[model samples]
Target: MDAIRIQTSAITRPSINLHTNPSGISFMKDKLLETDKSVFSVFGPNLGHYADDIIIVFKCEISPHPDANFSIQAATSFVSGNAFVLRPWLGKDPGSLDE
Candidate 1:
């Protein structure tokens, strides 16, 4: 599971009345495509701002293929590409609330 926490304060410019820049807001769409071109080839209903934070959970069969795991790719890209602060956390399991 890959979890990313974006700091809203960092993305906003206080000088601009705390309103997010239109270009900066749109930057994620570009980055999403760049980061996961294979995953989001068409930019259909798969993408949206369903929540404040982005959490991608991948469930795949354990395979010998090295490329099967792209969690690192997603995490690294988000961290390296953005100037704003983003807290990304990677875990083997998305712990249950009951536990």
Candidate 2:
């Protein structure tokens, strides 16, 4: 079942890309598509694994705006992860992140 588990993990969890900036210093504020954890939670269950937790990369391939949130919506959607949870958060608060 290890293979199944690994495959599930690989399929469920979205792959994150980290790249360097022209300044040679990386910053996370980039590529944050979602700002809500609840979205990831729901995305987890459908992924065949309990939503133990979400990992927010402090730095992403793209740079974040000064007022951007940590969650990246594209990360979840593209990976078939969790972009739904972000819908509500986006409706109410555009840049809200828990912890």
Candidate 3:
């Protein structure tokens, strides 16, 4: 939709990389900053795990998204709440249950 097109157009396309190291995430990110001649930072590691399930959050501005229903740029809590249903599950310890 228009939202994706606008966001993708404004967002920089990550450059081609040959390194297969898991840190290639960092390399692609570094290239983005390098191309812009600025320092890039990693806020923290492993939102869930080091798998591709990891997500990167860049605090950038977006024009009011028609689907976002927000007058301002989306915030983490706001976006997460709208996008996912968060719940906590209590699981028995495997060892205890086996005993």
Q: Which candidate is the best by TM-score?
A: 1
- For model 2 the local lDDT of residue 80 reads 35
- State the displacement of the C-alpha of residue 1, model 3, in Å, after optimal TM-score superposition: 0.6
TM-score of 2: 0.18
lDDT of each: 0.37, 0.39, 0.35
TM-score (all chains, Cα) for each model? 0.23, 0.18, 0.15
Error of 1 at 41 (Å): 13
Against the true structure, whose lDDT is highest?
Answer: 2
Q: What's the ranking of the predictions by TM-score, best on top?
A: 1, 2, 3
Question: Compared to the true structure, candidate 1 yields what TM-score?
Answer: 0.23
lDDT of 2: 0.39
Worst 10-residue stretch by lDDT in candidate 2? 17-26
lDDT of 1 by residue, 1-99 (tens): 122224455454443642443232344554444432333222123344531343454455633467753342433234344322332343323243222
The list of candidate 1 runs beyond 4 A from truth reads 1-33, 40-60, 72-99
Per-residue lDDT over 1-99 for candidate 2, one digit per residue giving the tens place of the 0 to 100 score = 999999988865543221222211122422353223222323223443423356554456434566543444444343332444446554433333431
Q: List candidate 2 segments past 4 Å from native.
A: 1-6, 9-50, 60-67, 70-99
